[model samples]
Target chain A: MRAAARPGGKVTIAEVAARAGVSKGSVSLAMNDKPGVSAATREKVLKAARELGWLPNQAARSLSSAATQVSNIGLVIARPARMLGLEPFYMEFVSGIESVLVERSYSLLLRLVHDVDEEIGVLDGWGRSKQISGSIMVDFTVDDPRVAPIAALGLPVIAVGHPDLTGGLPSVWTDDGAAVTEAVRYLAALGHRRLARVGGPATLGHSMIRSEAFAKAVADLNLEPGRILPTDFSGEQGARATRALLASAQRPTAILYDNDIMAVAGLSVATEMGVSVPAELSLLAWDDSQLCRLTHPPLSAMSHDVFAFGAEVTRRLMDLIDHGDAEVGAVPTPVLVPRGTTARAH
Target chain B: MRAAARPGGKVTIAEVAARAGVSKGSVSLAMNDKPGVSAATREKVLKAARELGWLPNQAARSLSSAATQVSNIGLVIARPARMLGLEPFYMEFVSGIESVLVERSYSLLLRLVHDVDEEIGVLDGWGRSKQISGSIMVDFTVDDPRVAPIAALGLPVIAVGHPDLTGGLPSVWTDDGAAVTEAVRYLAALGHRRLARVGGPATLGHSMIRSEAFAKAVADLNLEPGRILPTDFSGEQGARATRALLASAQRPTAILYDNDIMAVAGLSVATEMGVSVPAELSLLAWDDSQLCRLTHPPLSAMSHDVFAFGAEVTRRLMDLIDHGDAEVGAVPTPVLVPRGTTARAH
Candidate 1:
């Protein structure tokens, strides 16, 4: 095919490389915005390509891939966040993914699924129908049925969850287990012995990991088991859990909320019930959402860059899917966002 | 094509209507889940189809019409909201859109773009290329260069912003004019003669409408000028604006933020600056994000169901693209959410 007379025409990778005085492979790398090619070299290549009017043969490349790929990534999330909207983390992660995708002229196909089974079926069917290049897996549960079913299709898969639960596929997860321990240690340093926790759904793999860590940390300190309450990670459940904890005869002085939504809900319930934060009782949160800073007394949280985490996963997935089993592992470290929610335990 | 042998081989619309003792058109209405097929006839047709194990041939219909339509709705969004993660509004709106899409055997293609020009190019190209059957448009600006350009391509479009700005395409929007007036009236009722607002981007079609209403309402109440500060609808900008306003000697008693992120950011800044909310200052936000409830003292906001708004737009877009010309009109009106941030300016 010949280049069009219009502003942007087909500038081949060879022409780009020739203009930049580099190899075709180098031009390909620079055009795809991959690292190792210096920022200056990448810019020069892109500028040259634009001047030459180049568009990557994205559709053809996808069609000719070794695995009979579909040229796009499919992400099926469990339920829509609704009032929660796509959080900053999700946005940043998506931007990170798109940063790479747009360069390759690839698309990300996102969907909201009502159930795990439905998602499993969708993944299977889309793969079978050649509608996706690869899939992004999230919200894994113990003995995850989705993994087994998807694995059966021999589709290139990358999971965004703990590896232990993901059947050895390339996986990415935040260090929830270590993060829970850090939360306990942070509270302990503030002179709190008695503690309570409002956890997310016990079925989720990350939730279970964190719950176990909380127990082990408490057990090491010889604390009571009745203080831990597991509920679906939602604001309503958080409010209910807070009320029940506050009503208990052995009410703990410090409370840990699994996510920001629940922490905010706990904050409300505490206010309504007349239990002051970091005064009469101390509180903390996991998954530091912007909600933490919005409350009267801001919440201290176990913070991990969810956006970066998601971005990192997308990057690794692209690598593995493209290069066939690239090394994939992310450092699971948790940073403490010490806000006003926790104090020297009353 | 051979049937997969799931139940009764290919129980066509003819068979469904025959079983239900209705015409093929009635069966079409019933199977497509559209209104006006009568509840009795619809139920009977569905039951008969279920027993016979049939699925709709959307592809066949499209091919017959010379419409190589992909089974997905293209959702293109502009600016800061897209940068912010999945807010509950989009999550819920997308959820609502998806429910319809899935039931109709369609998928949703969500995209984020930088500006109107990029969008115009995308829509024009996609429509011309016949890659996407139709698109959902949002954030209408006055003299929107995008309007005539996309229309010329004859691509089906549905706007989800101000009706007047939509160029007669079917539109879905919350009544910003009414909502703004009510917000101003509420603040005036609370003895707030001096009120300032941090609104969305200047180029946005709805922002212009809201700003106009704000000015009108403020003047009607005989208030001062230079109180409306239009922002890019970002958390950082909102915080910065809040700081500048609060630092001034003539700062307003109550302030309104365009969206929940800005409200939350402003609230945080106030707390950091030792400002007492509802005591020293009152704050309100538009778009009723969950950030309101998550805050210490929840925010009071101009509330409306954005999810329903999105779904409504999606449905209209699908109809326009698949069925023909646009169905231009008004949608729902916005309401107020009374939360903890707004109080009497004593």
Candidate 2:
């Protein structure tokens, strides 16, 4: 393959080593920036490789026996810290990741960024410095800008989204669309005619999927499709959205929140406005948490084990890092756990 | 300083280099495990240094220009993940830590352990491997096992506790004792004779301090003291504790919770049991969060800027890493933010 690459073909490390008049071991050490090789020799090897246009196969280099592995896996989240403080999803997810990581003697290197560009920069730096062996990426948006850069850099990554959203990266995701349908259908069956959703940021792929599914479910049920209020998934926004929806002339009789916190907030708003729960209005939470049960009426929620889901993603990430082969799979669809929050619309 | 530590005189890195018949530069490189030194030369330097009893000064080694600084800070939290999932304290604290870290281009390496033993092991490994430049330790229980081992390992650390709990490490803390006193006194002035606290785990240093302060305040005010129920700080545990307290024959008219989640839970339990807010019972929260405002009748809180507190700890950690000089100081004491949850007792 090296001979064929001389004109046009696969270029091997041996060709670079031979051209630089260095031993194969020296070439390997030089390429990896290991301590054993001399600076002049490393320069020669690099010069030769550059002349031959022979880039070390990133996957191959990462798998080299002498590669120094850092004992931490990277996760970069791009969200406002205020939002993260209240969001139970990330904390539960991180807990699940740690459950698997602890047994394997790995720590989690977590960073919060303002946006995807910063996330990409962080991952690239971590990859270049070999600071993290692999990373788990979440909060994938439609046409995510992260996928190509991650692939180009050859960083071992397991995205937490559907395959299409992840840009071909290995993923572990829940069936959000089906869950939304179930939630809508359940609310519809409870004699609710007008309904609305307090959704997450519109840019998030999962939120988009939920919105589209919500639209479809409403159409199928032949109910007036209520407005979808997009937010940054903060309780403040949840309360604000709830206030707006209730104040409108065409107020929603029942409201569905994207997560438990929002649902709790929406419930509080209803009470503050003197609206009786499940009688004057109905509330349903998308992601169930301990917060759901702690509320006044014990919110009915679309419940799933987020901790277990996080663990599953970590498991696939480990598989990707070790074998370079991974397949996408969905965790169990969120099921409706009916409680006191929902009742027949008045 | 080096001459003072020698048998006859101070034996510095220069003396070791002279004894090994190597350049001073080589000795520095060998000691730091940097490139540009042969294996045999490194061994010779090590032997000569050992024979001379010229141990490398850990502080000086850390400060050396050649030290390969890892661009990440370590944080080891010993707690159940389930508890961590709903607690708003850590997320707020972490966000504050990140506010400072992002400016310096540092990432946070977070790990959760079941107990202090595991925390110690994780930190030891990270220190040995030089995977973190420094660390911030939190949630110190009574007689923390981490302090001595961490100090012995010469790993830079900033503890987030009062001086007594920090075991002589530089610290950043809030005045929990003062805050508790203020809370008790405020409730007492509000015409409440019977009072109780839903405290955090009794093992935690802060919890113990708060408990002690609560006891003293009760004695000072000459009011009927109420029981302090210890919990794991989970919302479920909070709910359970509230239930137990409310069901007791001599229930307290006012309750103070260790965190907002617990306060929220207590409020829910009160509502569930047909207790009225402020009319029949008053509730107060420690460690205020957005959850407070989102609750029905908005909970009163001992409000402090937890994000700012976290940033302060990170600031001190950074100082410890850079100049090796930091003094323990308290952040602002939490102040009473009275909302709908607290009022004059009926």
Candidate 3:
């Protein structure tokens, strides 16, 4: 049984050390499970700590000599801050990550960088100073420059991208390629002969994967060759791409967007051009958010629980930090949630 | 003239010490402008550092003995993770804070707590550990428990709320009462006599201020006493409130929502209930974001630039950290932005 009460108010390490008949240093070593303390001494110290109801605050734990006891976890995102705020994915993902972290009393050290090189510098600085116990790296690009440098730092990290792109680092990923294929096939089954895609920047690993999957699916189904427009994943870019696609004499009947914001922008463009949704043009969005439900014709999307995905990633990161290794992890693939936007071609 | 190239390689504190003919500890003291270093030694260290083109990394600065030289700023928010992700206000504000922080190469140490007592514990722990040099406090309530404990800690802080609520802490705020008065007068001018408000939690200081202003505006305009419904600022709560009001025997002809998300949800509820916007009912939203413009018949709002407000708050915080005090600052008040949601009542 645990101690019911403390005799002299709050417990401290000094009291625990005195009770254990050990020095303060030995108590710290025993509590952190470091190698310097003998097994018997560690047990005695622990028993004393238990009886005294002594628990280290997060700051004390972080400041301890053991390198793995840090309270801060770093997350570096290479995106403009302005764009990041508008995107629901990161906010939801962060909140999800926070859900698990609060239990452990760890803080998230968040930074936004301009590019991979800057991200590398930030990670290197963090590692050298022992500022963070582990990190989460995101936005992997094709043949990413950050992978090799980050691996060299030997920091515990969970890369959020496909295994092929993460360069052997432990990762948590979603099956974006499979999700894209499913979306294409679903649209085709609805008798959409011509399909087009408004994708994120072509350099992004997931975007490249989706583009290749889309091509393979279209060819496999014997549908008309589709057009793909790469964009910066902004609402303005999404609107511009939609305008260009709709202006074509032989426009596709159905369109898919890489994110919900782009799809919403595309919908506005269609309405401004006097094209009714589903009846004249069909739209599908990815990474469904509350914005989708608030729209007039709630968007059909390739929906996965992004919040859960973030929580999963954080769990993997914590495991990696504690054990020095973690198995590759995967979240559920995005599944099509057909709302009012998709219909059979006339 | 600055050094054109390093003689051997990267500049280190050791090299600066060697060049200045001083010990490494003296070099640190001089660089950080600590009291131990003499004027002559400080001059020599500065000259040598400039010649070598040496700059300290963020981690190195944080590890320095000087109490004012930390590179991390803490922000503790007391809200549920799920609600925070959907609000849009905090995310946009954080991004804006980040925009300025990135320029100084500082990191934002963000935490979400369950209540003010937990927040105080977190801040106290952060102070004890020297984890942060300064902080930004948000979401003040009447008779806030945090103000005294935080003031006693003596950490430089910039509270983000009205001066009346912040309890002598340096602050950055917007005039929510004035903004509420403006919204009410605008609606009254548009011939809306049966006005109502869907506000945030009544316990919040700003919400209380807005509620009082709203009541005063109705009485001053010689209109019927209006109704106020308090919510947790979720889209679901907004929808429920809208439904309850619409179902009343004498429903409001116009409604003003505390946030854009609720306004959007209210619009959907109106459509579902067969109430026509601007013809049968009018709505106004606050804290305008991209979500406001994306909806059908786009929402008119009491708009303020949340991003700029965040940046301004950060600037004031930096000033407090460096100078031990800052002037009470205010951002531009929310202004009326006319869109398709509001019109003269029939």
Q: Specify the highest-TM-score model's number.
A: 3
Query: Residue A227 in model 1: shift from native, Å?
Result: 3.0
| Cα lDDT for residue B107, candidate 1 | 67
Count of clashes, each model = 19, 2, 0
Candidate 3: tens digits of C-alpha lDDT, residues B237-311:
998999999999989999999999999999988988999997999999999988888777789999989988888
What would the per-residue lDDT of candidate 3 be over residues A1-346, giving only the tens digit for each residue?
1101112336788999999999999998876656999978977886676555455554455554333444888898888888877888888899888887887778888888766655765675666556678898898877786765566556788889998888766777999999999999999999998999999999899899999999999999999999999998888899899999999998999999999988988888888888899898999999987777867678899997887888888888887888776767568899999998898887
- The residue-by-residue lDDT of candidate 1 on B1-346, one tens digit each, is 1101112254467887788799999888765445778867866775665555454553444333332224656766665433545344555566567666766656666555665544554554344344456777777889675654454445567767775787645566677888899999998888887889898888888889989999999999887763777787667688899998899899788998888878888988898888899888999987775556766688899887676676677777766765664455667677877888888888
Would you estimate the TM-scores of all the predictions?
0.77, 0.80, 0.82
* Chain A TM-scores, candidates in order: 0.75, 0.79, 0.80
Tens-digit lDDT track of model 2 for A79-198: 766666778888788888988887786889988876675676577556655678789999998888676556655667888887769866667789999999998999899999999999
Q: Which ten residues in a row have the lowest lDDT in candidate 1 chain B?
A: B1-10
Better of 1 and 2 by TM-score: 2
lDDT of 2 by residue, B84-111 (tens): 6778898788888988887786889998
Candidate 1 off by > 4 Å? A1-71, A80-96, A99-104, B1-69, B80-82, B86-89, B124-131, B325-327
TM-score of predicted chain B versus true chain B for each candidate: 0.76, 0.79, 0.81
Output the lDDT of residue A40, model 2: 87
Better of 1 and 3 by TM-score: 3
